[model samples]
Target: MKKMILSALMLAGLVSCQQDFNPGTNGSSLTVRSGTSFGMCVGYCRQEVVIDNKNTVFTKTSREADKNPPVTCEKQTDSGTWNEIATKVNFDAFQKIPETLGCPDCADGGAEYVEIQLNDSRHRVTFEYNKTIPGFEDLVTAVRQQRNAFADCK
Candidate 1:
């Protein structure tokens, strides 16, 4: 009876669209979250992208003020994106980056960050794009590409 019920649930998940299903944050790891905040204007532009093995969510906003509105979009993780993330991201290297790599030398005051959740732990790395540190360029590039992929956010 348990086997039959589990099979039904699996079939249901396969039939659902990426948007219709919510993987929830239960037992899943391997999440990629990237974001940027720039400018000191009243409504600074902010963008964020979150993706896991199955789902992706993209969001952009000027601020909470009425001057700028928010844009949000949802997408299913593509095979290429999933594969790149799985193979290219070396979690070991990511862990080596100082957890508090904040922007000490950023003249512009703008910042960007990428956070990954794996093995039941969440790692966040922050930096200033203009003064990005060496040795972590590839990881930053991979994350920036993922952030750019959601340019059509609605």
Candidate 2:
């Protein structure tokens, strides 16, 4: 009887812990935007993805000199997907990161950026393309995966 009671208590504790870790239950709206750009390239020099509470939008554009219009595609975002990325966000730590890191797009090596807007606050961090930021590896990976999934967007 004691074993059974202890098991039940342990299960209840885990359930409450999970609820606390679930960002979706907090009732705050979140938006994540990630993008890459090249300073000295032509033909789709920029690509970006924006993930909001309800949808994910991807856009690719050419430089003004190329005279090409932007191309975009979008799809609905489910709660599972949102939660996956939202759980990676540590707003307090993110706010401490500098607005810019490394020499972005220096010598046309390319540049990447991630921006997040949660509730009434917004922050952006830009860095050299393909370079990993110390504390943001997981969040960056999640955003990159979402962006790459839309690579064939027209």
Q: TM-score: which candidate is best?
A: 2
Instruction: Give a tens-digit lDDT track for model 1, residues 1-154.
Output: 9999999999999766222112333325578888887766456378888887788888888866476678888888886776666555555667778865666326757778888777566778777753453566765677688789887665
In candidate 2, what residue range of length 10 has the lowest lDDT sum?
18-27
lDDT of 2 at 17: 44
Q: Tell me the RMSD of model 2 versus the true structure.
A: 7.7
Question: Can you write out model 2's per-residue Cα lDDT over 34-108, one digit (the tens) per residue?
Answer: 999999997899999999768999999997734788999999987788888888887667877998999999999
Model 1 lDDT, residue 85, Cα: 61
Displacement of residue 79 (Cα, Å) in model 2 is 2.6
Tell me the lDDT of candidate 1: 0.69
The alpha-carbon deviation from the true structure for residue 45 of candidate 2, after best TM-score superposition, in angstroms, is 0.8
Task: Evaluate all candidate structures by whole-model CA lDDT and list the values in order.
Answer: 0.69, 0.84
Per-residue lDDT for 149 in model 1?
85
Error of 2 at 122 (Å): 0.6
